[model samples]
Target: MQELQQHLEATEQRLDAFLVKLTQRAQELLNGFEQEAVNIRRNDTIYGQAYSRFLAATRGQVQKLREKVKEVEETQIMPVFYRHCTQSSLAGFSSMVYEWRNRCQAKILQWEEQLYASESAAIERAEWQDYETVFQSHLQQYHAEKEKVYCKQCGAKLAINQVYYYTVYITCTFCQTQNIFNPGTSARQLEDTARKLAEQRSRPVLEQQQFYQQRERDLYMQAHELQLSLIHEKNNQIIKEKQQAIARLEEQRQEAVVKAPQLMEEYHRSVFDELNNLLPDLREHHEKFYRAITTHYQ
Candidate 1:
């Protein structure tokens, strides 16, 4: 396993290095093309008139190199992806093919556009027409103008040279199963397949998210229940404390009521003793009158 991992890592590094090299090469090719176009506009040299040819050649070489890189990566990746990885890697294969297909299509379009932009010049009208005719011929020759396809399963080659049913299907002539080389497919079929694949890629992630969400909800519910139980216990403790306080206050009130009659009788006796002391002081101030009044009252 370690060795395989190391090999894969090394391969990835090499692939990355190659991609950098390819990018640099592509930039250089584009710069060369722009320079050639400038030279053509300036009428720099006899060869400058043929600058479009050089540009086309450079683009074609770049495209071939790109295809070579794709082939290398696919050859390395496909077998491992199928044998070692899970179902998810199937989408990776589709992506790899899509990239390669788009790269090829872009290159073809670039060359076609370049050819359309550049035209050969001549001195006279007839000469110009002849030049145009020859230029178109060469353009067709250099481009080959045929979309070539091959069967992935059986290695059968198909070329689009003319308007025919062959150009539409371009399938494997040997096996009519549409298993490998169906370059031309119906628009509806393509759309449906793309939609289905998009759904498939999302389905796994969606299910995983739902599972996590359900787990979170269950944990929250359990925590909430525990919180509610703790709160109920605290409330019960508060109720018990209130009951104890009320009971103590009631007992104190009962003791106060029991002592009330004795306290009132003592207060009345103290008041009578105070009045008797005051009467002796009054008799000392007025003795004769006090004696007369006392005898009369008696």
Candidate 2:
């Protein structure tokens, strides 16, 4: 029993040392990626390509770290405990493993948020701004050119009072002729641009929604961990306590789940509010799209 305790202690120390090394390696990778990202010009054509490569590399490195942790746990850490301890005695070691793995995974998630999320958002915003410039230029030209359209049959000048995304029939006041008016491709494409711009503006609300989503995930993980503990707990009292804890965690998870829809509703309302403001003429279309999205979520 003493030898087994010594083995368990040694194994834990080894895991701790291994985790530190892995963390160091992960930090180095993040530092290198950040340096590379800082050097890449946002306006460069290859900027997106470089970012994609960096993301893939970072994910690969994280995967390797995960595999290393699993390898060490299986080959060095758990085997000794499993061989020397009964099922109930193994529970503590399993919890330790769980904690170490969680820490490693959490570190990876932290690195991803620190190194990627903001940079990705910035890149998206920059790209959107570039598109917005072109879209505004074309919209201006379209509006200026479409102010007056002459009837083909009677050569009477007809006034275009509103922007049309698609083809329309304008009845000439002079000859009562139906003149076909096409807004052209650029004007039609404005619908897509308008939606994109609105979404870009509402990104902050979307991020808030994502935060609630992550909270739900974390609660679920906590509940699952407690369930595992319950499975391994031999003492009736401890098992009952774990079950109660799991119940509380499950309640919290349900509450978190409820918040997701509420937050999503907020995001949807915000997006369409911006959409309606940007293209008041297309409110009907926006409302239809919003209804479809909200219905799907429900």
Candidate 3:
């Protein structure tokens, strides 16, 4: 049992170290992107003439990193996450590594806006706000230029003004399934929104990213707190769970009383399901919306 404890601790450290390595790589990638962003923002240079290509490349980089994060979650995490550990360590998987995933995502969203603004001409013109807003056109012009915002799941046209700048999760009346939206996105991205939604349109996604990040942190925190109680106050229960998990593994290996497997595949599935259950559905639904908005102009 003591050996098992030591092994679990070592596995936890390995998982933690692995997450740090992934983050380091992501940071390195973004550092190169930051330098390119600086170059793109400078309209006086020849590089600025190719801002469109740079922008596409940067977006591609972000997408590539996002996919990598998903791959790690699907592959690397199972080894440690499924093993017998203190409940605290089990919960740590979500708060620690999954939190890193979300933090990177938030950073990417902020950088996306920053990169866009660097070339917006709006940044050079800004004296009033750090966040850029649509300012040049009027509302009537907005209506003429854009299609009505509609529920992607259903064909119902959505009311756009209420959530024009930031993404919102809305339950569609027709489909009764949650849908994500950045309402009036086409108008919001326009240089102006008839001055009515101008302020809303100019609002930076960085501010909105905070809300998403906090929501994720809150879920992990809650799960971590509960797991900590199991570690400290419910140690017996934790031991029983671990023993049962091991016994199942022993049976799977055709061992009655011998040393069992270090981890159960079932435990991994449960931990993964639990960690993802924390916020996966929300993100999955939002992704469809995210794709819609990101590809709107394309």
Candidate 4:
């Protein structure tokens, strides 16, 4: 009986050692998941705030520009006496309006740059958060499995408070008999569990590869679907951006539509007025202005 007790004690010691290793490993994996989740959440919060700011500012500016364009169209018209009124005050007012419009358009361009940068950053950060969630879910499953204790004999499973240990030594949880799991016992039961875990670890890389390969195939089919919805969200943002750009361009074109004929008429009148000997200099200056404006519009 004493010898049996000694064997039981030794077996219990080994089991304790094994459990400690498993628990530590499981905790390490859980810690990694938790840390990654925290980082992802932090990144998401920052990106979300920046994106919201970009959207708000851009929307407000575009709306203001649209309102200004409407007001200008309603309140001002190209005067027939524009050529006759070459006074310094008139030139200064015209210069001020031009400068204001140019400044507003420049601001719109700056906001466009900010929107593009913020949207791209948000997309990348969102993807990272999604990946982190997947990792934590898998880690949760592994930790749950690690909490189960297995029988030393017949490879049966054991649970907390499910079976009592015999003699405080190595004994089968199922059979309640010593020597059943003595040396030479098959490791097949634990081997299967370890194999499953190993397979779990490899799943993420496999999924990522599959995602890339399958992306082209399902693009059209899933465009209307909502499962992989974030991609569609990014696409919608791109479409909205393009539409805003088109509206701005159209507004500028309409403004030019009114100004073009007037500019040509004024050019003819100016040439007639200053035809003495400055024609060459005026033409050269006009050509330069045309080139610069054309470059800007393009």
Candidate 5:
């Protein structure tokens, strides 16, 4: 019993020390990845290369740590605990080993999630900035030509107050004719550009909203999966009760799913609101475009 106790104590201490070292190593890997991220543009091919390497390296480290935990559990901890199975105190040592394994696994999962989120956010921001640059260029071109609209009815130049995406009836100063001005495809495309820019800007908020919506879906799927597994059982009465429980879960899921469109509606409103703010001069066009798209949702 004394020797078993000594072995358990030594194993626990060694495992604890291993966990500390694993954590340090993981942090070191993360630090290196972050340093690479600082130098690489998210849109560049190099960014993907760096990310793949980082992911592989981190996953390898995690796998190694997991294998070490399992090794210790099977070869050292379990053997010692089983040899002294009659000793009740040895059960606590077994529990300690299990807890350590769970903790380590949990930490690894958390680190991976954090890394993924960081990468996603970085990519999103980079795309947003790229769109912003394009929008600014379009804006500059729009302003420079705002007063350059020539009256098709007469040779007179029309001093337009704002950018028009669609056909506008502008009274000619010289001919006094209502010249139907269509700003052509290039100008019409600016509305699309503005809309895309706004969407990119609000992507993070949309993603957050989508995350909860996805979570609800995942919960429903998990419950449905459980219900399917239970259906395979031989018991009839228990299956009936389980089916009823799953039905309730499905009902709840339906309720949540019904609310999903409203969330999308909110996101759309937010995107257009942002669009209007970005190009307040085109508010009328933006509102018309918003109404045109949202009518289907309604």
Candidate 6:
């Protein structure tokens, strides 16, 4: 019983060390995820070039982490578990080892569970919703600010939502002179951007101006609603699918955790099998080494 207890404690210590290594690698994976989050902002029109490189680097790191985990599992964890599970030891100790192996398996399962939960927290739906809701509200304020404008020509007071381009010409009813209005500073740079010339320079340019004003209002409404409309669509959209990418990355982390032990055990056992295959040939060499050492005493 005492011998069995010692073996059981030794097994636990081995598993504990493996767990510590697993925890450290899992933290590295989490840090990579956080770094990606910082690089990719929600409102970016395109993924930053640096972030594109980061994704590739992150995959390499995750693959390396998996390899390390496999090494630990095969080299440290499986030997302990197999030693207890096989019951080649004292008759009473087999039962104790069986219990110890089961306990070790439980610890492995718990490690995977904790890792999955940690990764999932990074891409959780509720948190994504919160991030977008705040951004959408801020975007709303931005739209409201852009909508406050008036016609510089007639001072006729354009609608709250006017789509002023680079340069537009308007005629005042009170005065009959053409007034060139540049609603925004960039109008001079992109002066020819508009397809129509202030309603094609028609006599009733005021009505044309009103038409353009209404068109701008419609566009503004669309832009504002769309920003808030498809948080889910944005997740799946081919161009800026940040949310989906993050979710996929989280799944990869979870997969690594779940597969770590099983993969290690399979590979670890194979390594031992290879050693066993060479053992018969090695026995002659082993004896020669022993005899060589014993000859020194003679």
Best by lDDT: 2
Model 3 RMSD, rounded to 1 decimal: 19.2
lDDT string for model 4 (61-126, tens) is: 444544543343334312212331455545534433343333333333444444444444433333
Query: Between 2 and 6, whose lDDT is larger?
Result: 2
Model 1, stretches more than 4 Å misplaced?
Answer: 1-3, 44-51, 86-298
Better of 1 and 2 by lDDT: 2
**How would you encode candidate 6's per-residue C-alpha lDDT over 1-298 as one tens digit per residue?**
6865786688678768877887788777777677655646443456356555655565566556556655766676678667656765565455555556555655665566566556655433212333224333543543454445445655564443333433566554555556665556333212221112211222143334344443443444344334333332534564355445545545554554444444434433343333223233333433564456445533
| RMSD of model 2 against the true structure | 6.1
Ranking by TM-score: 2, 5, 6, 3, 1, 4
TM-score comparison, 1 vs 2, better candidate: 2
Q: lDDT of all the models against the reference? A: 0.44, 0.70, 0.46, 0.41, 0.66, 0.49
TM-scores of the candidates in the order shown: 0.27, 0.60, 0.36, 0.18, 0.48, 0.37
* CA displacement after TM-score superposition, residue 235 of candidate 5 (Å): 8.9
Clash list (residue pairs), candidate 2: none
Residue 196 of model 3, lDDT score: 22
| Residue 144, model 4: Cα distance from true site in angstroms | 11
Clashes of 5: 0
**Predicted candidate 5 versus true structure: per-residue lDDT over 1-298, tens digit per residue:** 3665466567667766765676577556656655555555464575367656655665566567557656765786556545665456666455444444444444444444544555455444433446788787887777666567787767788867777777889888788878777777656557778889888877777776677676666557557555545634778888887788888877777766876676778888989999898878888877888898899778
Clashing pairs in 5: none
Q: Candidate 4: what lDDT?
A: 0.41
Candidate 2 lDDT, 1-298, residue by residue in tens: 3554565567667666777787677667666656665555364476378667756766677668767766776687556545544467665566554544454445445444444444454445434455467557766877776876799999988777766788889998889999999888767667777777777778888888888887887777777767755644689988888888889988988887888888889988988998788778878878999999999988
What are the runs in model 5 whose C-alpha is more than 4 Å off?
1-129, 150-156, 174-180, 232-255
Error of 5 at 153 (Å): 7.9
What lDDT, from 0 to 1, does candidate 6 have?
Answer: 0.49
Model 2: residues with Cα > 4 Å off, grouped in runs: 1-139, 154-156, 235-237
Poorest stretch of ten by lDDT in candidate 2:
119-128
- Number of backbone collisions per candidate: 0, 0, 5, 1, 0, 1
Per-prediction CA RMSD (Å)? 49.8, 6.1, 19.2, 36.8, 11.3, 31.0
